[model samples]
Target: MEYILLIILGFFAGTIGSLVGLGGGIIIVPALLFLSAGSSLFTGINPQVAVGTSLIVIIFTGLSSTLTYMKKKMTDYKSGLIFFIGSGPGSIIGAYVNKEFNLASFSLWFGIFMIFVSIVLFLKDKIKPLNQSSSGIARTYTDEKGQVHTYSFQPVIGILIAFAVGFFGGLFGIGGGSLMVPAMIIFFVFPPHVAVATSMLIIFLSSITSSVTHIIFGNINWLYALALIPGAWYGGKAGALLNMRLESKTVVNLLRLVLILVGARLIYQGLL
Candidate 1:
């Protein structure tokens, strides 16, 4: 029954994360923490361990979603690699810092961060594109429906932003897409599908770096991971396929609602 629950949790996390380009860690980490506090199966779980384990699952989720997106011609491979240059090292730093956080502090900050990401998502639609006045590398993409999108961003700024997002990802085990997808859409003017696809690739790379650091710290629960991985793996594929069918606006709205609810829950948990 415990394993069943873990599998279901992984599947749910993977589906939501991939559907919205979150990489699944956001859901996994928090759920683990909650289970630890509430149930015997996960009793005594710590934030570092949860974060580490969640990141491990993200590696699988990201790989599955990225592969799916790549096949659909939605992923921006070059851009993803470039962003990884910054996210990789940033993830390392965040994992190292994770060892110092107790559960309460971690929950509080993670909640705050989630709420902040939700706010950014709200602002994403309210803002206008900055690609016009921007001076940097410009790129173009055509979606499945033959609609064209043109966008640009300064590489230096993009790298800095990726670093920050990656730091948060490693710190919270969210894989960074909760922030990165919206940031890409708002700041880089990336089309929604391209941003989500690219985000998965970035998550795949960053999760590896973060999870490696967690491994060195001995923070992962490999046995628990055994249960979660299989479900998360298949769920990622399901999510990417679902993403192709959903409207971009619908996806963003769903993501925002989830973040707010999760964030509020975490904040309340921390206060106790």
Candidate 2:
């Protein structure tokens, strides 16, 4: 029955994750915490154990989404690689920091992080689009085929944001996609589809790193994590297909609302 519940939860988590470009940890971590509150999983270990286990599970979530994005060719390998270069190391550092922290502190910080993320999501809706007169370090690069590709901002900032996203991802057992998607769309002016795809790719690499760290630290629940994989796989594929049918603005607005709700819930849970 417990396994069955995990599967059902995984299905819901995966579907929402795929729809919004999160790594599923946003849903999975909270669900696990809620379920394990009075169970054996909560008795011996601190909240960090739950977070670490969620990060381990995110390996599958990341892979599932990455495959879906690859099938659609929505992933920009160049940008993904650049972002991964920074996030890879950052995730390791963050995981270590998480391991050193106590459970209460971790939960408090996690709640605070969610609140910050919610505010960012709310403010994102108010920002105006870039105008023609706006000036910045724009660059145009041509490939071997002589097609000119243009970018309106510096890549350096993107790398920095990726690092911060990765660190939080490792700490929270989430794929930085929740943060990366919005940042890419707003700062780098990436298309929503492109941002979603790129975020998945980054999540794949970062989750792999974080999972390895968790495993090495003996913080994973293998059986539980495995139970969630199949559901996430199917959910990711379905999400990729659905992405093509939805309007970008609609998706963004819906995701923002979801984030706000999730943030409020986390805060409420923390208070409780």
Candidate 3:
């Protein structure tokens, strides 16, 4: 039953993570923390350990989601690669920094961050895009529906943003997807689908580095992480497909809802 629950949790995490490029870490991390607090099976689980497990799980989530997005031709490989380059070192730094903070304090801060982010996502549609008068690096891509999207942003700004996102992703084990999607949309003017697809690729790369760091630090519980893989894999594929069918606003709203639930729960736990 415990294994089954883990798989189910992974499935939900993978499905939602792929759809929004939030990488399911938001779901996985909190669920693991909750399990630790509530279940004998997860006794001794700490936020850092939960974060570590979340990063490992994200590896599987990113793999399944990226493949599905590739088939749909939704991924912006060139831009995604650039994001990965900046995110790599940042992830390692974040993993190292995670060890410096008190787990309870860190968890509380993370919860607050998520709440703030949730508000941003909720109001994302109301935010205006960057001024187009200043032209950026011109780019174009086509989605699964044969719609071509042309947009631009300063590459340096995007790289810096990716670096920060990766740092927090590593530190919090949220895969940076939750933050990346919003940044790409609001700052870079990336189309929602494009952001989602590209975000998965970035998360995939960054999470690998973070996970490796966690392994060296002995933060991961392999038994728990392994239990989530099967569900995460299959769920990722399903979520990507669902993403192609959903409206962009719908996707944003879904992310907002998830963030609020998870963030609030974490805050409550941290206070206890």
Candidate 4:
């Protein structure tokens, strides 16, 4: 029954992850919290175990989704690689910090970040593109088609953002998709679809690096982690397909609502 529940949760999380490029952590964390409340199977180190396990499952999820995006030529590898370079070191540092620090700080930061994500989604339309604007920070990148893509900041700035996001990924056991997607959209002016695809690609590399760090640090629980894989795989595939049918705004709004609810729940849990 526990395995069944994990699979189902993984399926749902993967589907949502693929659709929104969240890499499954946002959904997985909340589900685990809810499941732990009722199930005796999840106790002691299970929460930490679950996090490590989710990261492992995300490795596969990221790869599969990234491949699909690559097939469609929606992934921007150059930028993704650059982001990965910085994120790798950041993830290692974050993992070490998580091992040493109390998780309450992480929970608080996670809540704040979620709130910020909600606000960004709420103000999606009001934000204008930074093209020829001199005041706002913007950067331009040319694609294979010679299309000059202008964003709110330069690539160097993006590296810094990726480092911060990667650190969060290590601390929270997420693949950094939640933060990356929004960053790409708001700061880089990437279209929603493009951002979603690119975010998955970025998550893939970050998760791989972070998972390795966790493994080296001996923080992962294999049996529990294994339980979540099957569901995440199927769910992730479904989510990638769903991206084609749903509107980006709809997905973003849905995720924002989920984040808000999760953030509130985390705060409540912390206070308790």
Most accurate candidate by TM-score: 1
Clashes of each: 0, 0, 0, 3
lDDT (10s digit) by residue, model 3, range 1-272 = 88899999999999999988899999888788778777887676787888899999999899999999998788889888888877888888888888876657866888898888888876767997662645566678766567887777777777888899999999999889989998888877788888999999999999999999999999998998899999999988999999999987888888788888888877887787
- TM-score computed on alpha carbons, candidate 3: 0.94
TM-score of every candidate relative to the true structure: 0.97, 0.86, 0.94, 0.86
lDDT score of residue 141 within candidate 1: 95
For every candidate, C-alpha RMSD to the true structure in Å: 1.2, 4.3, 1.7, 3.7
Better of 3 and 4 by TM-score: 3
lDDT of 2 at 48: 61
lDDT of 2 by residue, 1-272 (tens): 77787788777777777777887778887777767765664344455667677776666666777788787667777888888887888787777777876555555567677767767766765875342234545544443345564555445666787899898888888777778888877766666766776787888799889777777888777787788777777776676667656777876776677676676666676766
Ranked by lDDT from best down, the candidates are: 1, 3, 4, 2
Give the TM-score ranking, best first: 1, 3, 4, 2
Residue-level lDDT tens digits of model 4 in 10-82? 8888887888888988777656755766678875444455456667888877877887777767777777887
Query: Residue 208's C-alpha lDDT in candidate 2?
Result: 87
What local lDDT does model 2 show for residue 71? Answer: 72
Which residue segments of model 2 deviate by more than 4 Å? 38-45, 125-152
Q: Which 10 successive residues of model 4 have the least lDDT summed?
A: 129-138
Instruction: Report the error of model 1 at residue 79, Å.
Output: 1.0
lDDT of each: 0.90, 0.72, 0.86, 0.74
lDDT of residue 268 for candidate 2? 70
lDDT of 1 by residue, 165-234 (tens): 8999899998999888988999888988889889999999999999999999999999889899999999
